[model samples]
Target chain A: MTDLSGKRILVVEDEFLVALEAASMLAEVGATVVGPAYHPAPALQFAKTEALDAAVLDINLGTGTSESIADTLKSRGIPFIFATGYGQLAGVDPDAVVIDKPYSQAQIVAALRHVLA
Target chain B: MAVVPQKDETRALLGLTDRLYRAQGLDDVYAAALDAIAVMLDCARASILLFDDQGAMGFVAWRNLSDEYRSQVSGHSPWQRGETQAEPIFVRDVRDTGEPDWLKAALAREGIVALGFVPLMANGVVVGKFMTYFGDPHDFSAHHRELAVAIARQVGFSLERHAAEKARSEAVRDLKESGDRFRLMSEDAPIMIWIADSQGKCLHLNRMLRNFWGVPDEVGDFDFTSTLHDDDRAAVGAAMAAALRDRQSVTVKGRYRRSDGAWRVLETTARPNFSASGAFMGMIGVNVDITEREEADAHKQLLINELNHRVKNTLAVVQSVARQTFRRDGTGDLEVEAFQGRLAALAQAHNLLAAEAWQSASLEEVARRSLNGDADVRIAIRGPRVELRPKQAVTTAMALHELYTNAVKHGALRSSEGRVELSWLTAEAPRGSLVVRWLERSPQPILPPVRRGFGSTMIEQALGADLNAEVEMDFQRSGLVCTIVAQLADTVRQ
Candidate 1:
């Protein structure tokens, strides 16, 4: 149905609105949404348990730990995208797509397809 | 007519010549001259016209002439006379024949005839001429014309001298009035105003100076040098000598002993009064009693010294209090820092009070300085500048320090994401007293402590006891706001 159709997607963001928007965008592209984590704890848990999925990660969580989540996602076969308010993420995976905040639904889908491919 | 009254005319001419010399001024000269000529020749009306530097004769001084005749003479200038072919001779032809002028008609209504012009000569200058109109055309003899010219010469010189004397009188009168006003003003002045000769002896002193030194008239000569302080008399003497020698103003500060034997400091600035020839007449000086101002400065210095002593002692006491309070218990629980904080607040209050010389301190200045350690411009303001007295300053300084320390330890400014909004404003009406509000707003939620801490108690006591003002501190859902009502009457007293 779309460029990201039948693709598994993971979303990570500290703000609830951002996390919900990423999940919706993945669903719009006919991709199955995995996790939309509001904190680094849930995001890290999702990165370790979920298999073969593309992930979106928020670089700054209120708890100040997002690097560990990015590192965990890199160990898995999951391709990821980083959503950060501040510039340049620390310890991000080499293959991950870095998208700044306030992204459109189209951009999320396009980035998911690129990361999955 | 066979030249009747020749002897009567000779006597009249001699009388007219004397009247010319006795003329009071220009207007008098013109009137007497015209009157004398008219009476001698037996004419109806007479007028004299004097030309100015512009050779224009607009001035007409007349005698026995009606309003109509004077107006006709004034309306015409000397240029009109020059344009006419009529000479300095008599005009016996065409009397009132040319125009139906109102002047001619008015004169005819009164029955008048021939007019004659006699040139009034002074220093060979054609200054003006005289004219006489008779009711009937009559022949004028040579003696009658010669008398008119003689009257004109005497009147001209007398008029010039009269004008000069009149100007001199006005100048003298004005100078006398101005000098009298100056003397009256000096006597009424609040300061001791005096005039002294080169030897520092009194020539004149105003009423204030006499009252200030308590010198009585029975004391005979009011000696200005006697009132000078013993240690300063020689210096003042030497300075006056120097001023007279150099012809410059002299200034000195010395004590002048009052009649009650009380010595008062006087700052005297004297300038040598001189005449037009640069001769030194006397010395005029204004004496100001600066004793009160000097005393106030000395008091302020003492306050600063006391403040220094207290600060050093408080620091030493605080160090000992810290050691005692901290090590009182075997187990160290970081408990003594709480006590250390309160002592530091008191010390800081003293520091600000000393900085202002105990006159008054700026409320905003104390607030900003107290909060310096806590935030860097994180606080927003909402009030104009307010001045606080010494007592209010010390109390407010202590309270501000407490607020700053508390905010650093617990409030919004502690966190990087947090912000503070401070609003201080006085009430609309500033009559007998004023209401001041200090409001603090932050995003972080804070509730008023169940029991008031040392900071809150001190803030209440400081405002209430020291400032004699009411204080209200509230920790609301939005933020903490403290409002105070202080009477400006007590704070701004000097």
Candidate 2:
């Protein structure tokens, strides 16, 4: 198994099953998973108030976009990667790593490692 | 009667010709003709009459004639309007001739007992006449008759010349008016318009085109092709050349440079123009700017890409649900793995189809994706270029995945010396059918499965129904062979 011990990662997804799967995958690798915020309000709150090592954000929430959350993470110097079902994201940081949907645990872990490194 | 010499008569005739030559208009000509009649015929009252628009002779100019007398004798003509070869009529006494009683009474009331009528000739046809009246009953002399005919000929020729001049001037005015109207319409048109000469040189460009090219009012030698973008210039030129050669109307599109150096797509339609005599003149064309429409089409394509992304994301969510449900049921690891493998195969097919905007997917690409990085020297794949529709593409991908997995786990790859060959070709037995064969050669024969599994069921039942195909799996003493035959028309793209 891939080791992510001592890592505090924020997981943000709107779908319940996808969020549960992502959190489980992160916990299995020994990382402390933060709030799997399903909405933009809580996601922004976590980005602003929580002490974090990194974050994985689904580019879109149920009602709104995760742009504000991504912006908050950026201001705090938190390493982050974007996950999206969209082929491309508009008005986001171009340099940010993007993981396409239906991604495996291996792909997410590899991207997270690269961002953290 | 006092005798008048021929010499005096000749002088009066020459003087009448000089006055007629100096006449300015129809009124002036009539005044001169009436004067000549009185002097030549030696009469106190005289008049000039001509054909009116209604083809009746009406008095145009006269002297010393009563209105009552003129009204009673109006429209009286011995010859028709177009009659040629007629002689003059002289009535020395109205009472002695076959004259209407009303006319003779009117003439008697005006104290006119005798009169002379000389027919006017214009272009070899009699148009009207000149009349001379004498108060006294008199004898008609040949010299007096000759003088009247000579004066009538001069006045007729002069009237015809005036009519011709009037017609020519009116035609010139009408031509100028219509030309002005055409210029006004073309200049104010919203789209670019141009007129070219027979040699394809642009002779005129409307105000819109002038502003588009940033040219001056006088275009002079400006070449329209110079404004065409470099990449599209040749194609537009060829199309225009062909249209001109064939004398056919043409519509062509190309990118053109605007005055501000921005490129815009313009659709131009041109047709050959001909003169009234059917001689080829040139071409007249209009250009419509379509840059905005082009941008809108590109935006639509971007939206399609975004929609495809959303569909793939939905599929991801379903995969997550399946994983969670399978884990809670204490499902066997093998079953979960198999389900995930099937989902991945479906997604792989979607990726290929989406890349081509969901039109079709390549068969070779489907096979390679199903191999999932295990495609090595031990396995050989050979086939002609083939394309599959969306439904068949997904089914074929999943079926290939099962076959590849089975061969690796149990059949060909299970032995070091094992090899597998997968090939497809069009079948001759059934028209428009394709056959795909999977032949595995193992050093030792493998035992066939005793019971049918999900893999076989999916390959045989689902794929066969979806594609209208025939599926056969034979486990021989030598090796395993699998063949699938499907109607190309239903499952494959030609």
Instruction: TM-score each candidate.
Output: 0.43, 0.53
Please list all clashing residue pairs in model 2, or write none if there are none.
Answer: none
Off by over 4 Å in 1: A1-117, B1-172, B180-296, B330-335, B428-444, B447-450, B460-472, B485-494
Strongest candidate by lDDT: 2
Write out the backbone clash pairs for model 1.
none
TM-score of chain A of each: 0.83, 0.92
Q: How many clashes in each candidate?
A: 0, 0
Output DockQ, candidate 1: 0.01
Q: Which digits, one per residue and each the tens of the lDDT, describe model 1 over residues B1-494?
A: 24438687677667766766676667666767766766676665777787766676754676666675566546443334334332355656325457357646666765666767666554445556777777776677776666655665666565556756888899889977986677679987988888777565776677777888887633356786677878998888788778788889888888888878899988888989777898777888889889898889878766675554445344534544444445655536344555545555555555555656656777766676556544346765455677777777777777776666666566655665555655555544454265656555557786665766877876778777866678887777655677777666545532
Residue B113 error for model 2, in Å? 80
Error of 1 at A31 (Å): 67
Write the residue-wise lDDT of candidate 2 on B25-126 in tens digits. Answer: 888888888777776677779888888888999998899988877888899888888888879999889989887888778888999988888888888898
TM-score of 2: 0.53
